[model samples]
Target: MDFKTVSTIGLESSPVAQALAGLRANEARYFWNKYKHEFVTEPAANNPAIVARVNTILGERDTHFETAPLEVSDFEVAGVR
Candidate 1:
């Protein structure tokens, strides 16, 4: 299986980028070792569907948050969405 790197665009200047990158690397490593599949990610700005879904779910629960996500990831296998 091929491994894909996670996207951390706007997070470059963030103090937490290192930690987040480590976490993403760990997740990718786990998936590669166990399922032999790649873990991929993209900037949230590039994935409108995911952002809409997340906001919809939050709206359903009447929950509101101020911070918007800078990156997004979707995990899928066997044609599942």
Candidate 2:
């Protein structure tokens, strides 16, 4: 597979970086082994459309969440969104 394994989120901070990396690796391994798909993640700041959609859903239910997300990941396979 030609995919990058570690997530870029929270890498600058020392405390959580290792744990996050392990989590990302574990998720990747699971998908790769079972579904033959690469698990990838991106910073939430980079995905406006997804953020908007999530916020819209939250609005419909009148729920209040924290201001921003630390990271956001999309789980997809076979080019489906």
Candidate 3:
């Protein structure tokens, strides 16, 4: 399975803006892998077990974001646009 993701956001600086940005990217990756099962499986559908597993994995990560927008797009069948 193949998945493509795109993210766009605007950030406001307080003092440690760069550090916070790095932290945010790390968290994004963390959540990306945690919730990637839905994108990696065939026959797109919701699986409670898979979601539970994702939640479990994310629960182990300790990260915080002041304010950030997130988006998750799904496209099961990919062909010519």
Candidate 4:
């Protein structure tokens, strides 16, 4: 299929797309603790409690990101809102 058609294909109904989507998610969080966890912290040197809260939010977002539905429209690279 062409790139335009492929880009719009609904992932939920396509096994190939779904598997690819899942693989991307797995790769994204392969080192979630190492890469993503750090970004949760703000620029300011906050207290220990604030740091902990940031970690908690990052953990939760990672969890939900994997379990969420595979929607091609939701992931449109250029037009994502």
Candidate 5:
């Protein structure tokens, strides 16, 4: 498959494209600097396990995240979950 940069695909309909892009770049930088690992993202619909894990954690604290996430990144960084 051909690699696609964020600039080359999507974002035309997003009003906060600039901010979202900045956040994405920040995530990449943090993971790279802290763990020397590449950041990864996948559609939330395809990753029920990740979603369930997050919800379970929040449930323990009785906290709720009202908005559903459109994407998910799952990985351990430097022994931290």
Candidate 6:
């Protein structure tokens, strides 16, 4: 399978950004091999609607991440959102 290269442009603030990117790449490879799905990420700032939707979803549990979300993965896996 051909793996798509992932970008770490927005993850600069994280201390282990490169490692995180590598881990994401590994996840992409795994998903591609197992489900033939391509994992993609978008800069959070570029997609406010997605971010707001995520916040609303998280509100159901009264749990929210305090750190700024630099990027987000917005996709369905096998028809599950």
Top TM-score model: 6
Q: Write the per-residue lDDT of candidate 1 for residues 35-64, one digit (tens) a residue.
A: 777777778889999999989999999998
Q: Candidate 5 lDDT (Cα, whole model)?
A: 0.69
Residues 1-81, model 3: lDDT tens digits: 222332223224335545545555555565458654333222113444554444566667853445322222233333411
RMSD of 3: 11.4
- TM-score ranking from best to worst? 6, 5, 1, 2, 3, 4
lDDT digits (tens) for residues 1-81 of candidate 5: 011244412333456766666666677777777777887777677899999999999999999976676667898877898
Query: In candidate 5, which residue ranges exceed 4 Å CA deviation?
Result: 1-18
> Least accurate stretch of 10 residues (summed lDDT) in model 4?
37-46
Better by TM-score, candidate 6 or 1: 6
- Worst 10-residue lDDT window, candidate 3: 1-10
The per-prediction tally of clashing pairs is: 0, 0, 0, 0, 0, 0
Q: Write one digit per residue (lDDT tens) for candidate 6, span 1-81.
A: 124665566688998888777778888898889888977778888898899998999999898998877777877888877
Q: Pick the candidate with the highest lDDT.
A: 6
Q: Model 6: C-alpha RMSD to truth? A: 2.8
**Prediction 1 TM-score vs. true:** 0.64
When 4 and 6 are scored with TM-score, the better candidate is: 6
TM-scores of all models?
A: 0.64, 0.55, 0.32, 0.25, 0.71, 0.74
Candidate 3 lDDT (Cα, whole model)? 0.40
- Taken over the whole model, the C-alpha lDDT of each candidate is 0.74, 0.68, 0.40, 0.39, 0.69, 0.79
Residue 68 lDDT in candidate 4: 31
Clashes of 2: 0
lDDT of 4 by residue, 1-81 (tens): 121122323344545765655554554443343444211112123354554554577788874333334331111223432
**What TM-score should be assigned to candidate 4?**
0.25
Tens digits of per-residue lDDT for model 2 on 49-68? Answer: 77888789889999878656
Could you tell me how far off, in angstroms, the CA of residue 8 lies in candidate 5 after the best superposition?
Answer: 9.8
lDDT-based ranking: 6, 1, 5, 2, 3, 4
